[model samples]
Target chain A: MATITTTRDGVPRAASQPTRGRPDRGFGTIGGYIGRTVLALFFAFPIIFMFASSLKPDNQIFADLSSLRAFLPVGDISMDNYKAVFDTVPAWRFLANSIGVSLLTVVLGVLVNSLAAFALSRMRWRGRGFVLAAIIATLVVPFETFALPLLWWVNKLPWLVMQNGQPMWTLGWLDSYQVQIIPFIANAFSIYLYYSYFSTIPKELDEAARIDGASWFRIYRSIIMPLAGPATATVAILTFLPAWNQFLWPLMAVQSENLRPVMVGVQYFFQLDVAWGPMMAYASLITIPVLALFLSFQRAFIGSIASSGVKG
Target chain B: MSRFMIERRGTAVLAGVATAALALSACGVASTSSGGSAGELTLWTHNAGNPAELGVINQIVADYNASQSKYTVKLQAFPQESYNDAVVAAATAKKLPCVLDADAPTVPNWAYAGYLTPLDLPQDLVSKQLKSTLGNYQGKLYSIGMYDAALGLFARKSALEAAGVRIATVDNPWTAQEFADALAKIKADGKYQYAFDLGTGDSGTEWWTYGYSPFLQSFGGDLIDRNGYKTAGGVLNGDAALKWASWFQGLVKNGYTPAKSSTDAFADFVNGKSAMVWSGIWHSGNLSKLGADGIVMPPPDFGNGPKIGGGSWQWAVSSTCGEKAAAMDYITFSLNKKYLAEMAEKQNVIPATEEAAAMVDGWQPGGAKRFFLDESAKYAMIRPPTPGYPFLTTTFAKAAQDIIAGGDPKTILDQAVSDIDADLKANNHYGF
Candidate 1:
């Protein structure tokens, strides 16, 4: 038996390694690094510009646009734009609303969509194929195609409310948090992703769980869900993004300013004289949470997309 | 547990969830008609994020609400950018507020659509306001503004002097040849990158029509034939319009102005990048900060005369308002000369009434901005009064953009006329 060797970093190394050319490997590795660095800089430019511009005065921001100084926070930097952002918009309120809506969407979307996906993927229902096909077919019809009709229908949708200790039926769902959350929970793409992931799981474990006197709910809770970490992460990221970035629906459905999300607040800066500084500040503030979420789930998000043939 | 029982329970759970969702969705359906209960009135304004304007509006609302105990006005402010979409959505659901503000140009279309009702204000007060501030549809007033907006040629006096160009005025504006020669002189001077900033980069369709269509009017062309409010046949695509188009496109071709100005064209002019800027009067305060050398002059007369687009945001009573009387009362109360002057001063806008103008400082007879008031009164033309004005403005704006981008002006203008006529015909000239 060939003995294993330990590198200087204390990682184990195989002794019977195949013969490889060192020069080619070294050049290829350097090329990979250069390519990655270039790609990273390309995607990082906009975010860097937004954050950098947020600190500079409006005139300096425009003046520096043609130079490399735009990317560097080198001159006349202040937090006045950030202060103006707070004064101009109800930033905390909008942030709180967006967080609440996005979190609720992520949680409920995962549960409902995954459950439907479980039934469609694991169960032996008679018309399961047709139902799956129908769900997938909905991906072709864009949300804008049905936006007006959806607005009309949602306006007519009934909601139970308590006013002055009496139960009352409200006709329109125009300006409320529920209007933003409930309609987006059963996302079709999320269901398909979950279904696609669930079908790849071994059936033996589910059968063993069933034979051991476990219910379908118990099996889903104990067995399949634990292994759907990547899919769940991908769906959560996808659903949370659109919900947080929602502009059109909230603009139409919600009339009260206090209930509006951060995206709608972006329009508040586009008055007769556009407030470029305050707008950049507001954009930077709203982008932080999304950036954090994306960075935290970076690995699983990429893995799920790669494995499921999904492009984000 | 058996597989059959497990499958049944899963199906049952799914059915239960579906049922619950339906039940939850079904509970919000109660009929909500237009207007509020007897004593409460809902008023909407497009003044959110515009704290100065919103403050003036709120003060008026407060004063009016306190003036009488018969009605309490509840105000909802929407940001100006999405105000129209919100209003349209509310109108679609038949949930429009009892009182709301509409952009001046949309007044005719909204009135024709029964979204607005004719005003019943006292004629004495109505006659005191500027004619351009009144949203008249079919000779009946549908809306009224507290102030009017005007446009002017913003120039640096030193630049004009250096170029030996005569300053234009309301009485004797620069003719087409004089304007072109002035531009040529300034370009020959070569001190500035461009001679004029025409605000071509402002993408708002309203800005395009409001800022440029007046030049077309000056060239003896109009967006549509106003006599019958019918078509754009000879007016928009005629020889005069072609002349205006050629001159407009020539400014870019000859490098007198940028083919596309930046969003900060006024800023560029103030920063000494350009000598002249064609923009609205709102920039007067900012320009004045640059010193007494800043001059506001009338647009050059192409052929007929100098013209500027008229009208501003105005208040209206919805047709579905349960208390139209109270809504009209609030509008009337809000238009008090004192309130109008206060709005004009605080917002730095031209007061709608001559008396209010006299009350404000810069708008007085000999004051600095009286020039704008004179220009507005003398040359302001309200956009076409037909309900199809919206379609006309949009189509004209797109065609004008195409013309500036080097498309054949005749062909583009022809297409614009065809599109406008088709839209008017589709709506049967909007009740003529």
Candidate 2:
């Protein structure tokens, strides 16, 4: 076993490590900071520009494009665009709809996909390998290729609805919240992610739980699921982003203004004139929840990615 | 351990039973059909974000509903950008509303796809509307608009006078050489960033087809042979099209117009950044800011006469509409002169009928906006009214972009022609 030593900086260093191979402390650290800052700015400029331009009028947004002023709230700025956004579309309703849809998708997706994955990863099943392979194969197919066919299929599906205070059934899920959420819940990539993560968990925990009179589900629920923090966070984030940014599916599926999500609201500004200010304001408005979500789950999300070897 | 195994097996059995019960319950629910109930007629409009236009549509619906005791119209507004997609999806699901508004160019395609039904309105009412406003495919009138849009070259009179360029009129618009000289003189004056704004910053395929294809038509080349509507063979890749492509590419090379303009080209021209802007009549409202200096001129004739793409959004009755007569009644009632004028005034488009135009303030005879009406009457050429127009427009827009990007005119046009021909052949000439 390798021994660890505490350096003057309070960082643990391996006893077998050579100091010569380490990077220089002063210039290298400063250079790294500079490079990181440049990369950060490169990634952040578009968002900053969107936020800043949302405050400015249309012409000024174009006029400042040649200068650094484009990314700064400097000239003729106001909350007019935000006010216009409200008047143009029911922004709050769309935001709320998106929040509800994304949360339900994440929660339900976590349950269904994790259950499927748990069965594949832990249970001794006759066709588990083939099942996993089929699920993984679906990941290679794009959503757009089958979007129309899915739309047709969903229209043929029956749903239970409340009518006149009584439960009744309705054909076709178009222009409804369930149309947006239910179809997207059983994501293949999400199941695969959970499968990979669940496989890493020790089988001893399951055996111990079984000996203690726990059922298979109890083992999955009490042992495996409790330890799936990073995987859950990863799946939640991945599922949430697509649900929040659903444009085509919702556009095709839902028609009622009351059922529209924030992403579809972006189209409200693309009128004959293309209201750039209100559009940017709406974009900035919608991007906040996603940013908050990512920031909140940043650590767990990164851990999941690193451990599971998923690049995205 | 035996008790533990038995207990685990019992739990699994219970879980399976519960799931089966849930599935059975789900499958046992009574099913009902979708879409509007008996007398409720649904109307969809591409005016969700456009409050002014949407207000007019809502008012029409309200009046129509109040005017009838037999039927009630319910309005659903969608954003214009995604309106077509929504309609297409709804059509695919067989859930299209009773009445809907479709862009003029798409009427033929929709009609051919059996999405729309021919109108049953009186011949007098149909004939009263401008020819371009009537969305006729073959001989059947499928849709009609309350107003139409026309394109014009908006210029500042002071800039034109300073550049020594003759003011172009509908009757005697500038020739190809004269237009080129005007661009050169304006560029030499150095008073603006570019001599003309073609509104190229708009990245939509429809804009490219509507805004630029007329230039090709003026150069004596068409997207397809209007005679048969079967192929783009010689018409799109011929010598005339080659000339049009080269001249269009030259506009960017000569720095006469920005290859990619700002999103609002008229705004740039208004801000003194350009000498002129080629845009639709929608921008006519802001031309008043230029005071007496503003001039809306006809497009220059390039060998052929000046041509502009015609038509605007029009109302149609869906084929799936259970109440076609009621839908048509609502449509016809909404085309009143008062509503048309109101739409023209609020939306700043040319009223579709002469009587309607006479009611609008600026569209009357000798009115400031009469030029657009005159231009539309004389020069507007409707895009080929065919089921294959969607593919044709997209193909033409792509080819135009490639030409503007310095691709060889002959190669790009030929390839475009081949692609269009292949599509036409594949669609069996789209029931021509």
> What docking tier does model 1 reach?
acceptable
Candidate 2, lDDT over the whole model = 0.90
Scored by DockQ, the top model is: 2
| Predicted candidate 1 versus true structure: per-residue lDDT over A1-312, tens digit per residue | 345453332222356755457666687889999999999999999999999989988777767777889998868999999998887789999999999999999999999999999999888879999999999999999988887788888888777887766556887788899989998999889999999888767676788888888878898998888778888999999999999999988888888888999999898888766778789999999999999999999888887876678775
Residue B332 in candidate 1 has what lDDT?
87
lDDT of each: 0.88, 0.90
Off by over 4 Å in 1: A1-24, B2-31
Looking at candidate 2, what is the lDDT of residue B80? Answer: 94
Put down candidate 2 lDDT per residue, B242-348, tens digits, no spaces. Answer: 99999999999999999989888887888889999998887777788799998899999998899999999999999998889888889989999999999998888
- Candidate 1 lDDT tens digits, B98-147: 99999999999999988999999999999898999999999899999998
Name the candidate that leads on TM-score. Answer: 2
